[model samples]
Target: MRRVLAELALGVRLAFAGGRRGWLRTAMATLGVGIGAAGLLLAASVPTMLDGRQARTDARYDSPGGVTVPAGRTTILAGPDGQSGDNAIRARLLWPEAPGAPLPPGVPAFPGDHQMYVSPALRAALDGPDGDTLRRQMPYEIVGTIAPAGLSGPHEYAYYAGYQRATALVEQQVAWRVDRFGYPSLDVEAGAGGTYVIVAVLVATLLLPVAIFIGAALRFGGDSRDRRLAAIRLIGADSRAVLRMAIGESLVPAGLGLLLGLLFYLLIRGQVERFWLFDVSVYSADVRPVPSLAVLAVAVILGLSAGVTLLGFRGVTVEPLGVLRQAPTWRGRLWWRLIAPAASLLLLYPVLLGRENVGEARTGIGAVLLIVALIPLLPYVVPVVARLLPDGTASWQLASQQLRRNPSSSTRAVSGIVVAVAGAIALQSLFGAAEVERSIPYDKADPAFLLQARDRTSTDAMKQRSARFEQVSGVRAGTVALYTIYQKDIIGLANLYIGDCRSLSQLATLTGGCEPGDTFTAGSAEKVITIDKGEINPAPGVRLAVPAKARKATLIGSNAQGVASAVLMTTIPAQLARVEPGFVETRMFTDEKPAVVAGKLRGVAAEIDPLAMFTAMAPEGDRFGPLRVALNVGSTLILLMMAVGLLLDVAARLHERRRILGVLAAVGARDGTVIWSVLLQVIVPVAAGLSLAVGAGTGIGALLMRLSQVPVIFTAGTVLLPVAAGAGLVLITTVAVLLPAVRRVTRTEELRYE
Candidate 1:
């Protein structure tokens, strides 16, 4: 034990002494590890940050004790014409049953009768700089605002009315049992299977780059350290001692890097908090690493550094005379290189082809394995690409020769780039796939605006208000539809037109023309009027029955302008329809912008819920935006680490080739020849790795898109960005790092020393 402690002390002393002599190299090495560690920390902290945000959301939305509505006693507001809006506001009465009773964390207690507190978003809509027109329509006392935590989505708008007023409105309308008393939450109803697959892909994207960076950092200063340890072995150290010494040496820089990483994380925590997920930035406090995770990250970084250092020692066998080197000198077999990636493809085929309904766990494992497979494949591709390069310029030939001669070293130098480029391509392709805009099923060529009422406002009242609103400038035309919930249907129904059949045909898209007094049913073919359920009475004691199966009917039509499972077009007065009291859906075609038109109409009703037609047509920005940002940032970091690793490896190789460079100079070789030779050494491997990466990345991206059922779009911009950026970085690094080192080594003075 004492002897082991002495060896550890000696190893640490040597590391410090080495750093003292060449602090720049030590600092660079530390910086590389530090960047890698920082990435690991950030990646690991994502779950914690999301968890904290969820906790905050739950705390804000969950109610402790409130007037819980009985299961079947809830009232849903529909349009006055017995039609239901697609997104109808639920009516809730918040009166202070106990004035002094405590409320949930974010819920505000009811103020007084006739006055109500609204959600922050609703308040902004009603009282913002442009909300004066809307404020006048409701005319309730502006008391307080509900926090975003109390609602489903941060942008969701909600209304609260005096208990008596809300109750009276419910009594007059179609009232179901109250669902709950707490604020509503924005529920994400996407398939859990798809979400899991996306999440798994995201995790792989983050972790793979981090692993490559750390691996590169561990191998930094490889050649010099190997020679130094070789000398120690010649002096009498055994293999165990040599391994311990290497671990100790690596531990110094790795320990410092861990500290630097922690500081880096702290510095970037604020910026991380600003990163959007689901179009919302989480609270700053939520973007923190958990204590246990922070500790674990440190331990993992340390263990990885030590483990890699010891593993490298396996190539060196210690003897009393010296160390015998068994480093890979010749390419053994090319077929082995295809094994991992080929297996990965086999595993992915089922998922990508949709042959298997594998859950998230299998999908995640497959994704991780696919990325891991790419790492080993890169090194083998180096030699294969070298063989393909035709003999050309002296620089090119020299570079290709070196790649063929010692493929492993060259492969190691650019391995990070391979991983980074491939990952970037895959992510960009995924983003492109995700960003493809979905065509709106509703009318896109026409100008339209939707207006919905709040509280217990009737369709007639909404119509009167809409009539006044149509008088505003920029209004081209307008129509009002009453929304209601029917007892027989699961969804709400709407009255498309209340006038003659001619007006109904003019108002809606119909397959068949109708005459005056002719009754028509409008809905999707799937929900067609059945013989038993088609007896819709347009007026008191007046019933109309259709003799067609609901599924096979041809008179049905679909409209996206408002929420309605089916539309009833009749000459009966809308007020006489057996619709439970509901809100009115007023749609207008206007020359004015939707926002402006909505603002103008807000003053026309107590609540105006504008349909998000444009928003609905847009791609899922909330899901794809944050993912793009994360992948880009992570890829950039990985590329930076690769550049550093390449530079380090080139510097080390140049040091090894100094004598040869000096000999060439002595034999009349020009500075340009030496510089070109050195540049090729780095360039050839980079070209080979990048080529493989691009091909593999594109294939992987296409496969993933197929799995997600998104069309693969290989745009020129997306394809060229990663390649150009990688090539540019390589060219710049070669000129900046290798050129200078080559010029220095080829000097006459350097030759004289040799």
Candidate 2:
């Protein structure tokens, strides 16, 4: 025990002495580590938090142990007397009576056999049936009125459990698989099958910080313990003992880091809890943190890091004679042997991203690729980039030569910067692409107008207004069907978009081949069905078999096909055959060749300010917007931390090599020469990194746009903004490092260098 304590004391002395000698460097490294660690922890924790909250909400309604409802729970309701018309609607729950206060006197009752309870919101719109008459006809009484807890938009229902529960009950209480949000969880294998996508996002994002921290430790502390290990071994100290000391040193800091992380987590826990987008109070209040999971996760990270780091101390046949000389470079066949397999695994990303089922695989593969790519690639790339800079002033030239001489230093300086920049780029691109994809497809539109109506009664007024608007000069118009998912019925929420099908081809790129005026022929008998490329189950070119006697139409796919859980696209006449005619819709999507819309009509219908919308729809909890913003803010803060690290790296380098710069100044080297050298070495590598980041961001952005259900429009601003921002950051950070060095040089510090 005394020996162990002595060894530990020695480790502490070594750490503190090293830390003081390289305070700026140590701080730089620690800050890099902290930023990476914090970002990863925050990102990972948020998703877990969101998922747990969402899951808890969903668990309230679902069966335990993952049991699911049997198939065939979904059904369509035909109108009375088997009338083959728009009245043959699809509904899930037709409860006994409308849920609310008694109906007004002299109101007409529903004439049909008592079925289906109507929501108070919907029932209020019904101009009939006193509550007593409706109850007498059916036999159920309203215990209380229930509605969606808090939906984001007026037309949207954030809470979907009511519909799912109603459907399950109406279908004889079938045991449907409930999600955390109380919705019937779809078995979508790849796409968002559950409501808590925030968890997946959080978990995946954690990898960036983890990778950054590991890479920083490896690069910054490459030879941190070599001299100590050498000194100990010279005194006949056991290699294992030296290894233990080194591991202890790193573990000490790591433990502090994790504790700090946990503290940070707890500090923000209240803030995080407030952003529950759903009724997550159930999980939030009973905050029974799985102690085991936290312990396990921290232990695993530390163990893996320490194990890998300790491996550097192996093969130490330290001779007393050589203890005074520079330690030999480390060579381990383990890491070298593992490189090929690691690279191969990284290559799986493109394949995984393109796969039909990619939900879990993409995230897992993404984490692996990010971590592996950073560590092995950084050391080799940094020096090469440093050497590649254009020749200019001597300071610039010297800095380049210095970095080239010691590629390890270059690697340390650039690793954190790369991670921070890459993450920022990736996130910005992702969000930007999502925004663009969700926008309306067509760029050319003139005098386009949006008209929203409540219920089927306002159809004539809407149609007449649309006609009047279209008849005005220079207006070529059409309507887009606002098909929202009706969750009550188990059948895919098929919001039938009924409009002039011909103009769709003009509005957007069709996934399957479709041309304008194809579906809008004047009194034509041709049957055409257009499906989007992404539609599952009934894919394009595949024949759909409906309850027979109805003719199957030829598939004519389109890209502008809006969001539909299940889509059956035909002409307006055919659409009316399936749903209610009173719900018929038409929108004049005008080309407006001579003139565009009078105002900023781009994405007018779809432009959702996530923050404002979340509040407007679900004002009960503060979770939704805050949670999302926290993730983004945490990501941004990580980048800022990297910037600070870069500044520290530069400051440390200036101090460490202050004599070299002083000597250069004494030899008549101008301050410009010194400044240029630092800038050239620092700025060029960052620029190169930014170039790679942009290329990656663009390709990934495009892929995400393709995969996303929304219509993303990537403008020059999206591409150039991040790039410009990255370049500016590099420039500012580079200047900050050089200015202080120049000041020292001007003050005759070089004349005193021993």
Candidate 3:
């Protein structure tokens, strides 16, 4: 034990204070390990982020369920959820049944009628420049901020306004009576499963690349390290001593890397709070790394570093004179390379067999296995590509010769890129395929939109609002329509549409040229509506009597607002002179960007009616907006990180070859030839790796979709994105990073230093 510790301690000292060469090795190893550790650390925080947010939200669950708790002195009534601009407002107007009622989570006491408790995010929004609209909508003074214990996330917009009366709220049926704030934990609704699946795919996409890159990072400068070990052997050190020293050196940097990863994750977490991806954002506090996974991540990184170092010495013997490299016999074995492809097929058998209702776990497993399968085969593939290259210029031959002589580092450096591109592509394919399952009723990009007031408001008020919307830019046309219950000397209820002749014509087929006060009834009205006399009440201050001579019209079509109904009554202002019609719907067609138009409309509505909501009226549109957002955002980030690794790895490989480059310049090779030679050296392997990744990614993605019971969509954008990105990285590295090193190595000073 002492002998081993002494050797390990010696290596640690040498790594820290072991001259420039030792520092380079440490940098290479530390950077590679740290990047991977950071990815896994971030992935590990997912459960904490989700579960913690869910738990806090659950604690304050006040929605009225199937069973209502009878109101008492300890009970409170809460409700009237609405929105201000784009921010969703959980409007909680609490009316305590008696004094000293049990307060909601995070509230210290019951607020006065004019005061309310707002979440931190809501408070910030209220204080911002855009708060004018929100302030008018809520019309309450802020008394306190909701504590973190009562909120779902840091950026959630919510408020608890105090009201003295529960009478109005209860009658409206929007308010729920509850004696307590929280209920028992229940399973997440099925609607949330898509988000979970997206998360699982994202993790799988990142982990495989991270794992491959870490291995590549470890092998960045393996050649120099092996020679150093041989030199240590020449100094009377036994093989066991050398092995322990190597492990110690690898371990020290790997450990420092863990600290560096933690630092990186913390810095990133802070920046993430400033922005949201696909409506998904987390507070720095909520994103705590799971303790068990954090520990496991640390262990895996350290273990892999030591394990890779140990493997580096497996087939090679270090002698006093020099190191004898005994290459592995399986390096050229076609049989071994085929195993990866075969394994991938086995993992995807269920999907390939056209099985239905395959689990999400299988989709995730296939994505991982597909990317990982390419790694082992990369070593075998690179050499074959080199030998098969067409004979061309001297630079080509030189690049090929180098690849044939030493393909290990080239293979390792390209592995990360291969796995990352492939995995992201596969994940995207799953997204495309699974997207079919969402029952998007309308076109997502359609400019047609509608605004419906949650509360009952007059048709005149709705027409004024619609006319105001027309004045706003991008709104080509605006039509106001109302859907209400039509009852007159009737025992039962029937659907009714009240609109002008021009607006009513768009919804149903009329018998004659429509005019104001012209009442028409649909063919279905006689069957569903009864003729018996009964007292009917529709809206306050509004009474209706069906016209004595109503014409029959055919129901032709429906508008964006779904206004096609059994009874069509074009009532002029004179018939219901005092009626303030509730249930008003307005449709708008926009010529500008729908989102921008929607936001403007929201601002417009806040001033007119606070309870109004602007919803896109696309019948064939994207219903799962959030799921697609989180998926694409996560996939984009993972690919970018992988590209960074490739840049550093290639730069290191070029810098390490400065000696050989200097020799070529000393002999008579031009700068162009030397640069091109180095370019080919990296590009050959990179091109081959990228080709394999694209093929595997596409195949895996199709398989993933099949397994998940979704249509297989082969999108060119998703497949080619990684390829273009990888190719761009190589060119950028060659022109920017590698070109400088190549020029510097061409000088005589580079030769003199060695």
* Counted clashes in each candidate structure: 23, 39, 10
| Candidate 2 per-residue C-alpha lDDT over 333-437 given as tens digits, one digit per residue, 9 for 90 to 100 | 346635743663565455335554445445444433443354445555566676566766566667667666665555565654554455445445555644432
lDDT of 3 by residue, 1-754 (tens): 9988999998788565436645765775676677778877987898988887777778888754657666675455655435544356677778788665667888888888868999888899888986775576677889999987877766678888886665465655545677777876555534332334445555656666667666666665566666667678767787888888888767777888888888888887887666554334577787788999989988889888888887776533434353423232234667876776776677667767876555656655655666667887777778789898798998888888778877776666667667767766777666665554432214432335666664444446545666787887867543444544555444433456667676566556788778878888864455333222222354323345567677877654244233333677675445343433345666666655454455556566656654455565532233334545655575466556555655666666666667677888889889989888878887888788888888887877776565444567787877887688767765675577766666787775667653
The lDDT for every candidate, in the order shown, is 0.57, 0.43, 0.66
Between candidates 1 and 3, the lDDT winner: 3
Ranking by TM-score: 3, 1, 2
Stretches of model 2 off by over 4 angstroms after superposition = 18-211, 214-241, 276-283, 286-289, 304-375, 385-393, 441-583, 586-632, 666-668, 709-715, 743-754
* TM, every model: 0.75, 0.59, 0.78
Most accurate candidate by TM-score: 3
lDDT order, best first, reads 3, 1, 2
TM-score of model 3 vs. true structure: 0.78
Against the hidden true structure, what lDDT does model 1 obtain?
Answer: 0.57
lDDT per residue for candidate 1 within 453-550, as digits (tens), equals 43334435544555676777876433334434233454544333343333234345545555544444555422333212122443233233432421
The 10-residue segment of model 2 with minimum total lDDT is 609-618
Q: Deviation in angstroms for 109 in model 3?
A: 3.1
Deviation (Å) of 291 in candidate 2: 3.9
